[model samples]
Target: MTNGFCSDDFAPVKEAFDRNFKELGEVGASVCLTVDGDTKVDLWGGIADPKTGDLWEEDTASIVFSCTKAATALCAHILIDRGALDPAQRVAHYWPEFAKNGKENTTVQMMLNHESAVPAFRDPVRPGGFLDWDYMVARIEDEDAWWEPGTRNGYHMVNFGWTVGELVRRVSGRSLGQFFADEVAGPTGADFWIGVPDNFAKPLAPILPYAAKPGDELSEFSATLLAEPQSLQALSFLNHGGWNMNDPAAHRAEIGGAGGIANARGQVAWYTALATNDGRLVSPEYLATMTRVSVATSRDATLLVPSRFASGFMKSMDNRAHRQGNQASAIIGDSAFGHVGAGGSIGFADPECGLAFSYTMNQMGQGILLNERGQSLIDAAYKVLGFANNRSGAWCR
Candidate 1:
């Protein structure tokens, strides 16, 4: 088929795909774009299989790492809009046991902002720790926090999905994954899926090998923002038995932060719905709240950097790599928000432009976290919208 994007308009996008596939050893990759709520770019190339070199198809779903957190948080925001859960309410109100260990005062907003200090399980996290939903919650219930909740923002690490999911379950009486499907994915008909189901495993492309070597370039980025010098190498996100793509039973696993899997279509749809106020998933008012920066400026205990949190979502306190653009990636617009997966995959929306952009890839870059390829596409989008290199450190609401 002819390239969906105009040749001139798609130059940077095509370049990004080609450079990654060739120079960066990218195996399978896909990118999607919706402008003014219309799909302007839906393109995939490169091989999905390393063994036989099978090409990436239109329906390839890869595990979109932290990008899943946004979807999970979206579930919570849905209920918040419906008045089922209050961000400011004490978490104990929803799940009484959560009040143990001086946590009675912790609010749902605190947990979502990564301010709850439940980064790791405070216990060993193994494969099925994901399955033992109750044990996981119990652990959080009994343990003292690493820091005071709501004092600062930190990456929830492995515990974000569980913490948020548990609160969601108590409020909605459905597992995090189920609530997401019933309230978010199913209604939107987007390709994004959390807690992978058995039947859908066939279409997924397992994560390609990357994080093994630091190759010297990313050492600074690794040390500064990641809280560890060898973070990129020690980052074992791809280690789950089938972290690549999960089967049915695995779909219910509480990976609110990581287990989200999606093709380009799903990512685009999420932003499409988010931008246009497509009902049944998340309302426009709630969507606005999701990016409201619930936590203010401070050094995060886990991420060890300054950040702003919007309930269970993340916003930029400063211009970081993913926040790359004229104004800053995170500060693109008041309504611009989405999340990036661990590897090179990224998805987000800018309602101001009526645009949603996504890029998925198998090859993981050695950069600290954000991939240059994905950022390039976003920069091009900014150029198309006439805000190519903003530095005002402000977002137009």
Candidate 2:
């Protein structure tokens, strides 16, 4: 059921990918890894649509959830590199209306680091409000801060799109989707899209929700969602304006926080550029700054897990020992920085090893972070790279 090219040096990754289907319950998925700007592994298999029994193809793309945040953050960094945006500057400097609701002191870096405290809507979200960019931006403008800005960090959940994305739009004079397409994807030849076009012709795979088994345990975040209906954790994920993720209109909307659509190849291609510093994305010096840890909290307000972030990207977060059974962790190299989707999808660039890696899947996984199916593939890739262990939370050579 699996098909793709794999160099002999990286055959273990192929083994893990195939094992995911045979033993780990992977429905439809693709994984790509590149080292030194060269493709080393590209694999895809299983059913794209279980209902239709359509097999996944090489070009099949699906919504990657929060992985889209990395792309949106990249757009902001591009503007920063061009001197059109400043992280230390007040967000109101770019978007004046954002100064309302005690947010005048919030800086761009605060928003990027999830410390702006406007994590989610406390009031009921209007039906289909997420599909409208202006409505969401206005919601952010009027919403009160959950805590003092820049004091504590919380996972922005869905609002990262408008919070950070608005700065990109105002400074770049282009929408986040348009800026990424023209500046990043188009030049890099990546097949990813923020707002999928109406004429998009690629084989699109609809995400299949995770089916809970009899003995499945819940994480702190999951437990909160069920126990507290009106909590920030609940509002951030459940107050989504009743928009169906499978709807074509949802796919067409530029929900930069979670609406990205791409396959493994497309994600790896984009990361490869960032990893190799090919002079197309950002300068090497700036890229180094972008990948370093910007903020870390022992307990995230929304996710309810230990988390670390670099600007808008996620740094290596290992919660394996934080919780007993249902804990989830993403253990990449110390130099790696990227984002993980709601399910298990992930894309990252490890500049230390000159590596770019991505895993895309149709079947949603249970945990808030990388699940076993995705973590196994990452572990195998690191082993092939001669990493000794991840016992220290992150893979080390």
Candidate 3:
């Protein structure tokens, strides 16, 4: 049976959550949603550790991969609201070293919108070198742009955290971890963290390594481009070696793009603050800029798919290229903005619905986007809000 509570209006979400473990292959997971600052659903179940059969608990948390990008984007918005950062200013103005390799023209806004053109380093990266922030930042600073700056958009993948994190550090004079803790999580009381503290670090659920089933089961995208050694997709994800989410060092290191650690409740609380414009993180004026569509639709250079982005979050769009087999594509109303993690995890805020939802799990799914397990819950949530029937491209303003 699924554990935790749900409001009567949200009982369908819990039903879907339970079906995930019974019918789908959910190992360990949590799903939470908040509407207009009130949490309506919270649930968790299944085995966090198959070896020991440890049941997932209320406090259990795990890596949410690229979901961290949303948190990093919030950090940038905080700086923007404070007038400490100007999105229009050159990134080099804050971090002078970033000006090297013909990147002097790249603006901080471009970095946020995935248009900065330095998605990954061309040189070989050491496996654990990401643990050293200075090294990563220096490498990115010295690396040349993969395309002309500000002309196109591409998923920054691994480099996003370092690039955004370094900008946060340079401008705020605090590490991204420290800044997030003092500014965002501390104020909102969310248990999420960019660098999971040493005290709350251990006994975290680990992401199950992805394994393909028999007989050409891997998607053509995964097989052809993401698996190819020299392709940008492979290099971006594998350059730092296979990340072990359970490692203590991984918890301590602030890989803001890929290393955010949080539970479903934590994400819900954080996004609730965003959805309600509560001013706990940033002012509502800046929140509009943060959540609004910044870049129009485009074909991502590295991901080889149509992607629409705003600041640091993905937009809900009707790109048919992104719709096929994309369980994680914008199923939420078009006005929503949030980021999905590498595996199945997804967290987003729909201001129009005053809804914030998060799903986190230890079992990694094969899809690049949200898997069936998470999508089922989202569908149930929107149905309750009377917007399941309104998911056309026009839902976004």
Candidate 4:
């Protein structure tokens, strides 16, 4: 633990750790803790690469996938708290063309709640589209909802960061990356970034093995729209394997459904402000609203998952997030809320413990949620805090 903060009893998680580590070919990972705003368990492990024999030391970074949306949402909330944006307002209010179709009624609330149904691009992502904010939003505006807006839920998957980011840019006069950097990350001094800049590119861990080679009977997006389904073909129109190091757009340049990147310390720092009254990047009231489940029983049509989503953050038990229980339930606190990446990476805060936890791995895992190893560390944190099951109702009391 750093500076006398109590280290969590994390060793118990070492056994299945290999299974988790091997899946993603994870090179490095770190976990940071803040109890009542104190640092603890600032731990790191793994390697920078298998060939170079470099140890996964402190300061390594990895792409965090969907977790970045929480940070992006936080940035939007800052504007809301200051009276610049309204979750209740329609998207067309900010970008008039967004009213092109039935979306004329889509609200910021629907956007955050993932109920507006513009989950993927109506048109495929093409060269220059990643950098062209106008092109993306126009598709969102004209795109027909896979399911009627607000009638049900669907994980926006890749579209959320960009949709919300575009909303942010239209309202704040800055791209989501620029606004997040200048205000949220910059002010909090958090290491997280939506689009990683070139200067920090040197430390990025390569996506291990990348997407696993597809199965011969690939359950590719079905040929016809099944129940509430958009042709799975839309995904190709979205990211289409654009997250590689050779990709020129810089991972942050386009907020993929799965591409926010950061280390553990920054993750902890970002949430500590809200949980422990530390005030790093957001106002306490904004944090409260963001954390509270705004739509409790919503089920996502896009992902065909049940979800409990707030404006932008996700509730752990909901199917709405494709990566639910695997990561969300492994952590502590019913009041706890945050996002996890495609692999074992987790970044969440438990207000009752005054705790914030973030973990990222360079390796990738197809598992929808936290693996046994990641869960073990989560269990350890709870054990250290004096809760055996951690899920027992007593801790919050």
Best candidate, TM-score: 2
lDDT of model 2, residue 222: 80
**Which window of 10 residues has the lowest lDDT sum in candidate 4?**
216-225
The residue pairs found clashing in candidate 2 are none
Candidate-wise lDDT, in order = 0.67, 0.92, 0.83, 0.65
Span of ten consecutive residues with least summed lDDT in model 3: 319-328
Residues 1-397, candidate 4: write the lDDT tens digits: 1111234454433322444456634456666777787776676677756667666667767777778878777777878888889989988788787775567678888888878777766555665565555666667777776666777766777678777877888889988878988987776688887777776643666556436456522212222233223354346234433445324465646573555767888777778776775555666656678678887553345543355766887656522134333432334467777776655677887776787777666666554445555666666666667765643421333
Each candidate structure's count of clashing pairs: 9, 0, 1, 21
Quote the positional error of residue 242 for candidate 3 in Å: 4.8
Model 1, residue 65: displacement in angstroms?
0.9
Pairs of colliding residues, candidate 1 = 191-266, 195-251, 196-251, 197-248, 198-248, 323-329, 326-389, 326-390, 327-390
TM per candidate comes to 0.85, 0.99, 0.95, 0.83
Question: What lDDT score goes with residue 319 in model 4?
Answer: 28
Candidate 2, residues 122-232, lDDT tens digits: the string is 998899999999999999999999998999999998899999999999998898899999999998999999998889999989999888889977777888899999999
When sorted by lDDT, best at the front, the candidate numbers are: 2, 3, 1, 4
Q: Candidate 3 lDDT, tens digit per residue, 250-334?
A: 8889999889889999988889998888888888877778678888645677666667778988776444345344542555677
lDDT of 3 at 297: 48
Candidate with the greatest lDDT versus the true structure = 2
| Error in Å for residue 386 of model 1 | 1.8
